[model samples]
Target: MNQTQKIQNPETNVPKTPQMNERDFVNDQLTTEKYMTASYNIALNEASNQNLYQDLATIFKETQDCQRNLYNLMFKNGWYALEQAEKQKIDQTYQQFTGYKTQLPYNVQ
Candidate 1:
């Protein structure tokens, strides 16, 4: 079908579901709020515990360091890939311009 027809009759075969009742929706929202409040209280309690918080902080710092190292490695790898691609493009340009029979030496060795 063309774009206009498809847009006008998009997903015509799909069945529409019934909407939720107001009472049920309100009850779901209240339950979600209660759970969130409980979770906050638990987090506050954990934070107040000095030993637990100290251990958590150490673990968080280690995790942060690990993530930083991973990011650095990935960034270096991406840079290396881009450098290789640029070198390839330059080599192709040089070969086209000079009519070289073989690729130019990339290194001294």
Candidate 2:
């Protein structure tokens, strides 16, 4: 069938979504707020804990990896959001940076 016929007979092909009621919307909002509050508290507690720093560090590293993968996928497939030159510049800068390290300078006797 042609595009117009397909559009008119969408019920046979496309799935139907249920409409949300006021009570359902309120409940969803309440659940979202509850989770958000819990997450915020967890973050606050972790921020204050020394052991949690390590866990946070690991999470941060993983998040960075995920972001890099997404960037590569978006740009490599000609679906890049930014200009190619800008993307290349960012890639070069990231490559040039080394991770943080601690080293004390030698003291004269």
Candidate 3:
């Protein structure tokens, strides 16, 4: 039960050099897009002008999408990895969240 399982693709080898590799480039871009989206979220929250808010909102959506794309690409190339959650843990979490459904406004049950 203590065994760890990871979900990942076959890793692509890269020369460990001073220059950045494909994974590094994609990761950097993903990080940048994440930062941009966060900043846009803050700006949108405090934006006084409707037009400016709309424009920023559009750009935020685009940046968020770009981040997802980069993340997908990284995962495909084995640069990104994720742990596989145990079924018991997942079921417990699901039950916990389901217990909160009654607290919702409507009948989301």
Best by TM-score: 3
Per-model CA lDDT versus the true structure: 0.49, 0.49, 0.91
- Tens digits of per-residue lDDT, candidate 2, 1-109, equal 2222111211112223587744344445545555555565567466967778677666655555555665454444433334234555667776665221222254323
Write the residue-wise lDDT of candidate 3 on 1-109 in tens digits.
Answer: 7566999999888879999988788899999989999999999999999999999999989999999999999999899999988889999999999989978989883
Tens digit of lDDT per residue, candidate 1, span 21-63? 4434444554555555555445545697788777666655555
**Global CA lDDT of candidate 1, please?**
0.49
Considering TM-score, where higher is better, how would the candidates rank from best to worst? 3, 2, 1
List RMSD in Å for every model shown.
19.1, 14.0, 2.0
Comparing 1 and 3 on lDDT, the stronger one: 3
Model 3 segments beyond 4 Å from truth?
A: 103-109
| Highest-lDDT candidate | 3
Which residues of candidate 1, in runs, are more than 4 Å off?
1-46, 79-109
Instruction: Give the lowest summed-lDDT range of ten residues in model 2.
Output: 5-14
User: TM-scores of all models?
Assistant: 0.31, 0.35, 0.83
